[model samples]
Target: MFCYQCEQTAGGHGCTKMGVCGKQPETSDLQDLLIYLSKAISMYAWRAAELGFRKEEIDRYVVEALFTTVTNVNFDSERIVNFIKKGYNILAEARALYEKAASDQGRQPHKIEVIDSWNPPQTYEEMLAESQGIGIAARLSQLGDDVTGLQELITYGLKGMAAYADHAAILGISDPEVYKFIHEALNFLTADEGRDADALTAMALKVGEVNLRVMEMLDEANTGTYGHPEPTVVRVTPKKGKAILVSGHDLKDLAILLEQTKDKGINIYTHGEMLPCLAYPELKKYPHLAGNYGGAWQDQKKEFDEFPGAILMTTNCIQKPAETYKARIFTTGLVAWPGVTHIADKDFTPVIEAALAEEGFTEDAPEKTITIGFGRNAVMSVAPTVIDAVKAGKIRHFFLVGGCDGAKSGRNYYTEFAQKVPDDCVILTLACGKYRFNKLEFGDIGGIPRLLDIGQCNDAYSAIKIAGALAEAFDCGVNDLPLSIILSWYEQKAVCILLTLLHLGIKNMKLGPTLPAFVSPAVLNVLVENFNIAPIKTADEDLAEILG
Candidate 1:
């Protein structure tokens, strides 16, 4: 198993024997095969699009298939094999679509040796063997490290884009532009041509450009389906009774579960990225919706085990379930584990039964609360006050300090950075990384809370909108504004978000708890020279550098 598409890749290099995320060699290799299948589908799908022929199901299948390979999303090899089998059927349909288009054009179809002319294997062992030819090391040998690294960067960015696009599709939102770019990008990776570093880098930024649109579509989906998030105080403590904890980034899954368990005496609590769901008017209307239960995904081992009710992981950020709570934890959507119960049909009756069986919180815990839901609408509503504060020099700077959190050692830098932020500045945070400092009091500038929680990672669109609005008000480009982006990335989603920022020509951002192992030194230099992007140093050192 050679994988290094995440920030926590082993020893700052590829993971060979097993993923640091606890993914086995077979599972990892099968995921590679699944990716190969998705790329094969895209090769035909891209041409079909060019020929003015497209199918929504084919587009959605490729998106979900790519999403399934994202870090920590799927660990069940059997489930992955099922996806691979399904992919072959879709690939045939894609091929036939291309043929129809080609026939219309009165020309023979174009072919690629490995992708278009290849036959998918029938069995699991054959699939594993198939992954070997297309694996990372094999590609690195075929193409040099720099080119392959850039290609992987684009691939990982596409995975992130697929995740957000899938989320938007669930909310009944779809865009052909997003689908077109995804297919084109994947096809570019599938073909042997255009593997030069400069070409690959340009494609990576284009992935960023499309990712921005996907994020915007997702923002619209969330705010339109559920009313725009309002500034509301959420309980961070547990309520006494039967409970079900919903972790991960899927708000739709949380809403469905809340409806199913509302009158059944199960109190639903959000964990990890789901913490922002409490602010949505449509979701927050549930009477039995309890409160947040835990921190980021990396701490789930201790937190999930201690929780006394059923736990449902709606999307990614799943860990190896501890034996103490293994039977009670369930996986749904694209998330899976080898032996964990999976809710494929969205009927969470099994989850409710398990919750009722367990002794949920013996009694009410001490009450604690935090304010969330400072999304674009919530923040822009008070734009006048924020603008006045900035003009009057009441707010010194704005710091965007959050991303996907992890179990890495240097992550405390975020907590310390937030703690050390000046009293006059505002911190706009999102995703699970907010757990590092959301619990602490950052006070407020006039009526504005100093720490603004801008929904989940996908809600990055909200943050971008907020910044653009602020920049417009100030009559300056975003880079000229007195704002600093301090981001921490753990997985592929973070990779795409960073790319989006760079695509916008946003500069001088600090990214850490470590750079991705997949980024070569030459590529790093290019980013640094062009965008002024740099890895984070100590909290104090970075603070001094930014403030001074």
Candidate 2:
């Protein structure tokens, strides 16, 4: 398959035989074809936009198709093949719109190149044949790693923006600028005329800027739809009842599931990234909305096997299902597996029935609980006290240590780093990566919890807001504050968030367990020389260096 878009590429280079994420060769090839076609749609959409023709639907599809290709999102070959066919249809429509717009302006439409031209295949076999010539390996043959890496960096960042923008769009929040950038970035990647490293790198930074807008849109959509998050304790034990465990990042799916399952005698529990959903006032209002069931997506194979209930995945971050519990698992909204039932149109009837038929927890698992929901609103609400605490010497330093969680051995650094922080310092975290140390009791600094759980990875917006607030209060730049950022990234979403931090000119950030395989040495050097981005060292050594 030759995929290296994620952190855990095989042997730190590429996954050639099969995806480490359990994506089969056929599925991987189909995903590549889908991306290739989506770029064609983007090329047409960009030209159409110049002719005063624009379609938000096409713009959204561009983002979504790219997002579907992200790691651990979709694995069903049939589903991915269907997405490619659908991309062909979208591209055709976009091309017609572009041609019409050009005719209206009395100018001839630009000629379509072979790479950007596609026709729908009649069968999956034909689709696979078409994919061989359109994969990343072919693109790399024409461009070196440095140029290709920068292009992929921009493309992956756009994918992350699309994922966040899709979530916000569900809640009826969006920006035209974000959509315009999507079309522009896609066309840039699809162009046959090669771009130099400096130009590609410049476009990548622009992706970061647009990603900032995308994240802001999502922040507003989430807070507006579900109310600003507040600190609350969530039960870790599975309640005794027929239960439904919901995972992934789609709050809309969770809301609908809660509504459908309410008063039906089924208890709803959050799993993985869905754990933060419990803090939303709108979602938490359900009396039967029980508690969280798992730590992070990486641990789900074991966790899902152990949970005696139906599990629903509403977004990405799905693993290859285990045979024992595969039947009880359901997918929706771009997440797919071969054997699992999929809930489309927000209809979770299959999941509900599976939960009722299965044997749920006969007894509560334990009385353990964890605290979350220190979002921007919650933290800012206590801003005065925080400022006073910092001024009074009760809070000496701040560390934002969080990102995606993976199964790599070096991941223990995050847990160790969190554990080593002094009592006087506050460790703020968000995303699944926080699971590393979230269960460890860090106690509170006076009245403030030492380990502040911001929302999900998308809630990096909250961390940014909190850091900006702190900087404004202290009358210093964010880099000048007594705060350090320690991030561990797994996928493209983390790429966008890291880019957003860079867009804000935040420097000296530490990223680990390893740098992205797509980041060539030249690209890495650019990041280091400009932003001072550093790979992590041992936890003890990093702790000593940051404190020093």
lDDT of 2 by residue, 129-192 (tens): 8788878777778787888888888878988888999999989998877787788888887664
How close is every model to the real structure, measured as TM-score? 0.99, 0.98
Candidate 1 lDDT over residue span 423-452, tens digit each: 999999999989999999989888789999
RMSD of each: 1.0, 1.4
Give the residue spans of candidate 2 off by over 4 A: 115-122, 192-194
Worst 10 residues of 1 by lDDT: 111-120
Q: lDDT values of the candidates?
A: 0.92, 0.88
Candidate 1, pairs of clashing residues = none
- The most accurate candidate by lDDT is 1
Root-mean-square deviation of Cα positions for candidate 1 versus the true structure, in angstroms: 1.0
Tell me the deviation in Å of residue 196 in model 2: 0.8
